[model samples]
Target: MSRATPPSLPFPPHIHAWPDRSTLLADRELALTELHRHSLGVHRVLLLWLLALAAIIGWSLLVLPVQQFEERDPTGFLLGPVFALLGLASLSPSVIAVVLAVRRDHQIRQLLDAWLALDSAPVSDVRLRSPGLSLFWLLSSLAVAATGLWTSFGTAAGAQAGRSTYADVALDMGIGTILWLTGLIGVVKAVRHYRWALRTLGPVSTAGRR
Candidate 1:
């Protein structure tokens, strides 16, 4: 009887079998690089989110002392619903991010299963990171809220005294200036980043469609 030999396995063209000693080290390094990249993206998203939240909280606190509710008149009732809606709207992106993160985690799991089964794995598209949409929403909400607060409170305060003091004028000016500056900065940054991301990601999208 002739001795039987094992048949060689075929792999996809993109996959290469490394020599025994190099295999472990090479794969570990590749995984490390991937993990590092993912970490950086997560870090950036978190940083921008926290910065936006902080700015909102800070601006709200600064204006809280100056808010006068009495002279707000008929529009006063709208504040409750407006703020509630703003809260809901502002939460949308965070919720979307969480859902995407969860979905990506599931995809990673699926990819790992394919890898372990020695099957060809699908490539993941790296999404272009931009804080543009979130920044826009944040700025818009802040602007509306800040403007409402100023209008309502300033009117109420001014109605009582019928005159604006230097201190009152200075405080009002300072708050308005800060809110405007922050909103403008956010808008500028968001637009620039968004444009860049769109341009950069356009080719990626086209390749994906093919």
Candidate 2:
């Protein structure tokens, strides 16, 4: 009798292959390394951005003589609101980074445990994308845009009242516009990076393995 060929596996055979423990471990390491690399880059950029924003807010407060002006002055009246906007923008990113960091740590621990387990089953799919971060970015972008709109309205009102100079209004509007644009760009980039990561680490099927 002729020997028979083995049955054909499912589509995307490479991904669905039931690899040996060593191969599984190697794949896990590769995935973890890529994740860590991207995570570090994202965290570094966000932290630096937050620090720079804080510095700008501090410098603006120190240099502007808003305190000397009476509360009746439009510039003085707008000072608190403008500072609050900047502070909130800074806080959103900080909170996102912190939450991500904690989740990342937990993920690392789970990955390690999965790799060390004696069972031959494929690892469960991990959630690389964070909904919390996505939500924060979405809300932050809206907040930034809203703040810009408010600044524009205030600038127009001040101009009409002859209390604020054109240069001052232009500067505030420019800053607000920049913040809104940058925040939007960051959200897009971060989301794309996460999606790329998920695709790169192809999900393994646990149908056949124990």
Candidate 3:
């Protein structure tokens, strides 16, 4: 039987050229390592759908009817479970994203450590920073944080002024907190990465590679 070669990885670029063939092997290996996490980029979205299904199934099969199955009171059986379901539906996305972000950060740090130990020279050639994406993330996060601040405090102000109901204010605050924390975390993570890259990557600190 004839031997077969694996197809090349999907590399994103308009023009393709590798000028220096000397470090190509190391560079390819680095790309493959990065690709491992990038592969999760879209697949992780399935988690949202999975969570939604879980919520629905849990509500239908367990929550709705199982509450004092013999009890005849509708309020006890329905109202409490409905509110809990609503809470889960509202909060699960943020919880899931936070978990994923933490996991990804760990994976990235592990990769960097492995590369540092191996003295991977290819790290120098590629620009590890994505300026455009980074800019978008920073700006978008700030916008979200700003909106959240308004929603959080502005709603309270309205409620105190008798312009809004307590229940309405509580809902708004819940939403605002999620947005505020998410945006703040994004901003902090970006800053942390910048500082870390500065200290670890170029000339500030010594890595085995560069």
lDDT digits (tens) for residues 1-210 of candidate 2: 111211111223243344665665565545544444344344544653574365446434432444325334566556756765665665555446545754654464344344324233334323333445545655565665566567656666667545665445555654565455545555554565455434543332422242
Clashing pairs in 2: none
Lowest lDDT 10-mer window, candidate 2? 1-10
Global lDDT scores for all candidate models = 0.43, 0.48, 0.52
> Which is superior by lDDT, 1 or 3?
3
Which pairs of residues clash in candidate 1, taking residues 3 or more apart in a chain or in different chains?
Answer: none
Candidate 3 error regions (>4 Å):
1-77, 89-97, 120-124, 161-163, 203-210
Order of quality (TM-score): 3, 2, 1
Using lDDT as the measure, the top candidate is 3
* Cα RMSD (angstroms) for every candidate in the order listed: 15.3, 13.8, 9.6
lDDT for 12 in candidate 2 is 30
State in Å the error of residue 130, model 2. 2.6
Which candidate achieves the best TM-score against the true structure? Answer: 3
Better of 2 and 3 by TM-score: 3
Across 92-125, the per-residue lDDT of candidate 3 in tens digits comes to 6546766775676656555554444433443552
TM-score of each: 0.34, 0.42, 0.59
